[model samples]
Target: MTMLRDQGIILINKDSEISSAAVVAQVRRLLGMKRVGHCGTLDPFATGVLPVVFGRATAAVPYMSEYDKEYRCRIQLGSSTDTMDREGEIIKQAPENFDASKLEDPSYVEQLLNSFLGEIKQQAPLYSAVKVAGKPLYKYARQGKEVERPWRTVTVHSIKLLGIYHREGFELPCLDVLFSTSKGTYIRSLADSIGSKIGCYAHAAELERTACGPFTLDQTVKTADLFDCFEGLGRDSKAFLSASIDEGIVKATLTAFAGFPTQAVELSDAIKLTHGQEIKVFPDDITLDTVTFTYNNVLLAVAGVNRGLAKVKRVFTDSSAEFLREGSIDEDI
Candidate 1:
């Protein structure tokens, strides 16, 4: 079965019990492409919007990773776990006589959730993919060796309590929360901190990403359905490639650079850009720090403008060679 090396992005509504990498791997296998990658990593137990990029769309991964994410997480109070999630071993439990009703108060819950609305520090959990000294932190955790995890400053754009879930046997509260946060904000860590603030043990019992940047759960193809569609495409390589670019299943690579300023250059200048040459732009045309160069509505390159010179930062070209510069630019800008 042959396929085109066409550039595109696909949003997968990842099912629970699957890692983000696994979703990408499945897409890679179905599409039969070697240059496939995911924009962000989701915990194996967590589900929702996983953006899988293939072909030259892989070049957009770094930029897309900067997108803000939204998630709906369930925080179960009164018992804490080693991994700060449902999958971990229980490490602590609230006292039997603990006042679990305090968490049920909507006003109090509102106050507690409000306290975490802005920038906050979070320590990387031991049972996480975060690397320490060239190895994943989870590796050390499995060996019973404790390591000081790095602290990250992440922002919560908005947060609210969706509803409270009370289990019959469980004495404490389970909070269903919906939040929109900056990239790298861990919902699991946030849930753990909420428990800590309540003076009780807590863990993220469930997590579902509702949105990632511009991609939403509604736009995603469920894993099972995606496979069926791939199979349904049959052996027509052209049809397979065309289906891969469908608006519903796959998005154009340029979508990843949405909100970045765009400058449409002449075909000659676009050709020069693809060759890594910096082109001159007018001062009026260089308002944004970074700009995407295009020709005839197709993306050519993303460049940083300095003193009227548009220097290529990332090249998105029809040519086989796609180039990325060293040192990261601020994608949020």
Candidate 2:
């Protein structure tokens, strides 16, 4: 028989130089599991809080991806890149009429930042991964093929200009910014637009994600540190990787995904949940769009509550028709 898989979310302080897919592959090798999935995609030039879900926790991917994210970015004025970031080719320059002192005034900079707040519409970068006609935009851009990218509406939520700094070799002025934004917002695009709004051209020089919903950089482990732990594992290695792994990454039991608030469900209801049955929900729990059903210290289901009942959206635990029969089930379920 196949053994039960150890599953939970692992937050990695992603290395900016590495692609997100590489991080997932590395984790899969370290734990020897095939079901791992990353909660968000970070560009190779960006790094910080990347949540990797394993086994049963994979059910939480869609729900967790919706959380607002916070990023710390460096915006270099007077220059713009085709990719909207340092990695891309420079394609635009600030108008010569640019006054270096305009950004020196804090109030002017605040106004420029405020313009990004609330709903804003933008065209996705040509080098972006956004798909058009079922093909990634970047793939077309690489071949010198032009595809009309659609304008997407996204919210900045909030923005704060940290400070302006000087880069010795580069001619442009750079601004450090921290902002929380909706899932689809691209910081590089936002940075470039802010520069244009202020009559200066800019591209994202550096980016590091600091937070995503309740998860923060504080809980992440450096990518190198995580892999170094399993450098010598072999037949002689300790059997339990959970006890050996950092942050209980491969632990069977974990805190229910905080992205969706939870509600307690009785034993019978949980058993029925596995079969996708709708169970009665209390009035107070009705307000929750997604409810986690917890019972006996285990997360049994992530449900959608409506019309005074909860319907299973994602079931983590297994249930059998035999168990649903009265007196046929045991407490172990």
Candidate 3:
């Protein structure tokens, strides 16, 4: 059987104004292929690293989203918006006599940011896509219905003030910050929380995710250049990064799924993996909690470790036919 399309991850420097779903649709259309998904949702107004998964890589979305994320955000003090960002209407503002200088105090900023560094409970924004009874909470919000907002524990790895400065204009004072957080942390809510701590409600004035897992925004390719670059890439070719998929894609793909050290599997193990069986490995040599199974550098599955066994957890592709046709199918999957 002939395969359909290349299966790998595409790192995009997603620009603001486009929804994450829109990016997946665009990639699906451009590649003339289906089975596309995004690693995580980046709000329409927030721009930065957005990973678009294609074909088999779509299975890795769960693994990808579990990675720690990094973001640079600007929060404006003295006013809070209904949606927790500037895009929403102002719902509350600081008193006229509220001192903007408190926002510019470095010591005050450090203390406030430190308070959120560990595990803390955060409430999802009311206008977000969080589900309630199978429908997004935003729908209930729009229907003039109030749902009990659930608070979840999200770890903030670190939060640092980028600088203590404010815009000298009619706009409210702002604080810029760089933070690394675990999955499910809402930066907008954190911004609003920061405002409350400062005795004035605040909202996210601007936000951009700089990193998602191992993919950083600085190393991302602009979404606009993908049409030509993607057209030039072939399934067997390593151009996942270049407008042409580059070897960087191959290297990056190797770790995209489990992000664990890989152990080479014997060609004879293919049939075993297909049957959902575990393979034997030297127990002393295996140090990681999990391992990726590869055959001649072709990644096939991520396996769980127990004693000396490697049990297949997720199989990325079916190379059974190719193995039969070529007598040895060793292409990267």
Candidate 4:
């Protein structure tokens, strides 16, 4: 099996009905080397763009989490579910012949959506993975144990109605919406709250993540294609390719940490550094020593200390291979 040499980001176009963890596992096998991690999580019932970080790019996870997310969602009206989604048990139902006009009134929908914008306190649904006393809240709910969950504040940047449609003489109404929100905003809770505002019950029917930070569905690769690429590469070629990729990651880390200009290096030219000097390298930040420019985070190499000297370190070919071989494979997926 060949390991990836460069730290790069993989944009996966995930489909519904499978857990996010399952997708990560499949990618791990395809790549054949560990140290893979994802930026954000999507529920098993939801699907869309999922960005994966490999090798030193894994260090970018925290920074990625802060990125804005966008979702295309559908909400079914006049019926409420225990979990605040269509998959949950129906807990309440409104009277038949519910006037769809109530939902369309600008004052009504605008008021409801406005309440959710900015900072607001919300209670996470019971059927969630939030931990309580070292156990998941959903785990307790399945056992019929009721627990009080405190409301937490979340930010919603914007919410727009993409479209609205209703079936003639149908009991329920549904709305298609687009959401641009900060991290941790629950679409299900938003649905539940909106339903309550209009004297009807509602739950999420469908959700598809369109974007997360800079990653979008258009840039995502299919799992099958990634697998095919993995199978076609020869072992030696794979090793060499993976090593080269790792070196590129080290260089990027150095550039990021040093706050050097992105164009500082010429094509195929390397950054020079000195041995045994503590130099900071940034993989995702201007400050902080998240990653060091050295061999195994030690043993700095001397490239030169002139004004033109970009911190260059001695390349360790064998160590890069060993690092990939011994790197941790136990990822969340």
Candidate 5:
């Protein structure tokens, strides 16, 4: 088995009961590449779209995290857990008679969700991967140690109450919620906070990521399907590679040149130049005469305009000098 050192975004429909790292390991083994990494971490109990990037595609991680994420979450009201999820031990329970209408009451639920919108303080659950003193918080939690975690402000773009179910024999109501939030927002904590707001306890029953920015569950491939695709490609085709030296790369390079850490920006202004467009070089302190852009560090294409701005030329999959710097030497030569 040969690994395709290819660089591109891989959409994964991550299954439950497996950690995100586990999925990456599987991909590394099947693809026979060690450069595999994921954009975000999904809990073992949660399932849905998990984007994996291989080789130079790992650079896309920060960019992808900025995109809005969509989730379908189920919350059980009236009971609380240490981890704020069903996986944790129940810490508290409230009376079952707590009005189910509290979730639907415009005066209550709306206020609660609204308060959570924009910027607000949140404390992560103890059984989380958040690091404390160089150790994961869960390590302390398992030993029955309590660590003070400062609250951080996170933004919730939108929260919609999808459905409210009243389960008998349970002290509180259950809810199905659809939410779109900025990165780093914890849905488990949100459920716990909402329950607290309503004078009841709650914990997350289920969570499925529906979408993350441009990537969606609909576009994700199962682990099995990915492995099958890899095997079908065979050895020769496994050397797949792709590159793009678009505005994103340019911006990253410029940031690095300016002595600042590279930051990923959503490139909406990048226009693929066609043939015959004028290549203009501005007289500035920072000028990148030629830049190498890659998907996973695999040279895809280079972009620079000719003297005439009338049309742009795009040489796809061709490693020509036009895309290379003056001093760059071709390894093949």
Candidate 6:
């Protein structure tokens, strides 16, 4: 098989109890490549779609990180946790007479969920990687210290209550909810917010990321299947790993840039782009905020159009195949 060592994005169905970084490390070791990275982080206890980029595709992380995300979350009411998730310590419990049935009223739940449909303020959880005074919030949490977390604005595109269910050993009411949110929206925090609105404490019992921008769960390969492919190669391991940059991954990477307006550039201009040179474009021809320049059917660089000139915002080099910036893909999911 031909080694398509160009650029590609592999969608891995990350399993729970493992950090996103662990998944990336496993893929990096299995693929035997150093230029590998991911787009978003999923908590260790969370599972779902994780897009791992290898080769020149790693340069596209910044463009892919801003995509809206979709998650299927399980929120249990009547108790709260220090970490805002099931893995955290139980910090508080609802009053003895607290009623959880209020969540059962579809109308009431819908109204409450609707309140968060637009932009709202959220405080980073104590257990999150969000930094405070140059230190990770989790560090302070581990030391049993509390610090004031600044509130940030985030948008919740949509929320749908799937159903209300009961867990075997837990007496609290559990809600299965699907959320479509802008990047950086924390489902754990949202669950706690919903609990507060319901007059009971709550925490995220489970979380599964179903989609990240153009990448979806259906496009992901199971972690076990990926390992099987690697181990099955035997003496052909190197060749198989090199050829694993299949068409699907290539397509996925291209899809990440599909939102940008495309313009074909001559070979001369393409070379200029890689050298950080600005190129000329028709002043009135600009129709979008940003444009993707291509040469010979391969995406070369992304540019921001101002006035009549196009400035290179990001350049892609096929030979280097190294990550240009740090993003997620290994921290959480």
Highest TM-score, which number?
1
Candidate 5 local lDDT, residue 115: 72
Q: What is the lDDT of residue 61 in candidate 6?
A: 91
If ranked by TM-score, best first, what sequence of candidates would result? 1, 6, 2, 3, 4, 5
Supply the global lDDT for candidate 5: 0.62
The root-mean-square deviation over C-alpha atoms between each candidate and the true structure, in angstroms, is: 5.8, 4.3, 4.3, 8.9, 9.6, 6.6
- Report, for all candidates in order, the number of backbone clashes: 0, 0, 9, 19, 10, 4
Model 4 C-alpha lDDT per residue in residues 145-244, reported as the tens digit of each score: 9998757888888888766777555466688888888887788888888887777888888888899876677867677765555556653435533543
lDDT of each: 0.81, 0.77, 0.76, 0.64, 0.62, 0.79
lDDT of 1 by residue, 158-259 (tens): 898888878666778799999999988888889888888888879999999999998889888887876677678774444665776653466777777888
**Candidate 1 at 299: error in angstroms?**
1.3
Q: What value does the lDDT take at residue 104 in candidate 1?
A: 70
lDDT of 5 by residue, 192-241 (tens): 98888777889998999998776678767788765555565563224322
Compute the lDDT for candidate 2.
0.77
Q: 196 in model 5: Cα distance from truth in Å?
A: 0.7
Best by lDDT: 1
Looking at candidate 3, the ten consecutive residues that score lowest on lDDT are: 235-244
- Total backbone clashes of candidate 1, pairs 3 or more residues apart or in separate chains: 0
Candidate 1 vs candidate 3, lDDT winner? 1
lDDT of 6: 0.79
TM-score of each: 0.90, 0.88, 0.87, 0.70, 0.70, 0.88
For TM-score, candidate 3 versus 5, the one ahead is: 3
Q: How many backbone collisions does model 2 have?
A: 0
Candidate 4: where is the Cα deviation over 4 Å? 1-4, 96-98, 104-108, 167-170, 228-333
Tens-place lDDT digits, model 2, residues 133-205: 8998999999999889889888888999899878887766789999999888889899888878877789998
Error of 5 at 21 (Å): 0.3
Q: Over 4 Å off in model 1, which ranges?
A: 1-5, 235-238, 284-287, 319-333
